[model samples]
Target: MNIVVVSDHAGFTLKEDIKTFLESENHNVIDCGTYSKESCDYPDYANAAALAILDGKAERGIFICGTGIGISIAANRHKGIRAALCSDIYSVRLSRQHNNANVLAMGANIVAIPLAKEMIKEWLKEEFEGGRHERRICKLDID
Candidate 1:
């Protein structure tokens, strides 16, 4: 799977770690910026990652920031992107299984590295259960 990841200063280390982990799992990863610990805008990276996913350049995206909320909000502004801010395994699984979320967002300060890894693993492994949930997702796009 091809995945795009982006982060700001607060999520720099976590993003690097996640990228390495994903690559080790044999997934192609595109690391989109704050390459350094220097401060940068989260929306820039969020938009870039979301566009990549929308354009079919990536299968999914993972975004991280201080609290995850801001970047997730930015990513979801795009019409076809369903970005979910999740910190646990259950929410991660449900986000993909039910919501068909194409992007996952996490908080560097709120979740530990190991927990984040677990959540990502669960999220990637679960397939979207689209039967009953399809109607709700359709409603989301209709607006």
Candidate 2:
């Protein structure tokens, strides 16, 4: 699968680790900036990831920031983007299974590396259970 990932300075190191991990899993990844640990706006990276998914350049997106809240909020501003901020395995699984989330957001500071890896693995593999959830997701598009 093709995945797009983006992060602000607070998430820069974690983002690099995630990119390497994804590549090792044989997924094609597009890494959007902040390339360095220098301070940068989270919205810029969030928009890049969201637009990539909207344009079909990637099947899914991963966003990271200090708290994950800001980045997810930015991504969710896009009509078609359902960006879920998940910190646990169950939340990650449910985000995809129940929410049909195309974007997964994680807090670089809130989650440990091992747990984040597991969360990402679950987020990537779980299939969306579109039943009643489909109607709710559809409602999200009714703007």
lDDT of each: 0.93, 0.94
lDDT of 1 by residue, 2-35 (tens): 9999999999999999999999999999988879
Q: How many residue pairs clash in each candidate?
A: 0, 0
Runs of candidate 1 with Cα error greater than 4 angstroms are: none
Writing each residue's lDDT as its tens digit, candidate 2 over 1-143 gives 99999999999989999999999999999987889999999998899889999999999999999999999999999999999999999899899999999999999999888888899999999999999999999999866
Candidate 1 structure lDDT: 0.93
Q: After superposition, how far is residue 99 of candidate 1 from its true place, in Å?
A: 0.4
Clashing pairs in 1: none
